[model samples]
Target: MGAEGKTPRMTSHDAAGRSDDSDHRGYLDGQLLIAMPVMGDPRFERSVIYLCAHSSEGAMGIIVNRPAGSIDFPELLVQLDIIQKADQIKLPENAESMKVLKGGPVETGRGFVLHSSDFFIQDATLKIDEGICLTATVDILKAIAKGAGPKHAILALGYAGWAPGQLETEIQDNGWLHCDADPDLIFGGDVEEKYLRALRKIGIDPGMLSNEAGHA
Candidate 1:
């Protein structure tokens, strides 16, 4: 929502939009939701959303391309009042420590770790798929404090969420086009390219897309 109007409160439907007939159950599990050119919502224009979990209950994902600024892991630690030696460079497992990412516009103050399955939160972990997971507990942080965290990770500070049927409606309206989810899309590679790249997974050049998704 940044620079745009306040993040619209997600109701049972998306942006209070009219209902559409597009089926969304096919969007379950690992998928990528790419914002079409006609998506008027400033928050999503050119945005690529990595769908972690989608179902009748609701939908959840992360915005991979948004950067969290120059702040890194050690800087975040200092902000959190966790003192570490100035010489103690690098993350717990030799990973980049200051790689915090802006996950979404909502809950800008919260944090979510979208990471590979090599690490678990011991108890507080959301398994998004076979190879990806999300952790929000401090236990994972502790592991990272000593450089013992997962092999691959991107610490995001929020998440993209949707109400049941809301996302389905959007898909129907051509607001979003989806494809099979990829781990690298969520936690690896260029964040900004994820959305466009996702569209390519299905061989759909986003540039050639028509706002009106006409189903025959």
Candidate 2:
């Protein structure tokens, strides 16, 4: 579904509004969704999504794999005017190596930072899990430019979302397989191996996985 604008900032309340609702059972918040081969949507084919919030209302997540091609973090800083071009080389090691990811198909123009919880802004950060948080403001970009941001972070240019019962139906139809999330799976630098790794983590060998549609 479509959001309001290009840069819609999601607060903790917005992300986890129905989190405590008793009817919001079996939600997959803070988990990983691995797309099965039978998935009908090409955008999510072979995708590995990190569920940030899940409740009776809906679900939101970011694809941890799928690098945003040729998008350099330092150059993005310059483009956003967060830092001058001359200061590119002065960026921290973490900033220099930060990977820019295509989070999903929706709101592709916006940037969302899925980061470690070490850094936070009073009302801008949405803590998805113990060590993971999501911040969608440019203020975090400034912090990164100054080397004062989270220990680990990735810039995702959009996010995946599902209406109430949509994700559950997909799971029931064997469109996805879910498993627990870890820092390595979410923040690891190897963008290409996440899908296969996630399958293996759930004890399913990729080679043996079939395109059959059945319960996950």
Specify the highest-TM-score model's number: 2
Candidate 2 — which pairs collide?
none
lDDT of 1 by residue, 1-216 (tens): 331211112112111122322565565656677777667788667777777667777877777777776546665654554446573564454444435676777676666676778887544666666887777765565566767777777766667889998898887777877776776777665766766677787788776777565532
lDDT of 2 by residue, 166-214 (tens): 9999888889989988789899999899899999899988998777774
Cα lDDT for residue 63, candidate 1: 77
Q: What are the clash counts of all predictions, listed in order?
A: 6, 0
* All candidates: TM-score: 0.78, 0.90
- What is candidate 2's TM-score against the reference? 0.90
Which 10-residue window of candidate 2 scores lowest in summed lDDT? 10-19
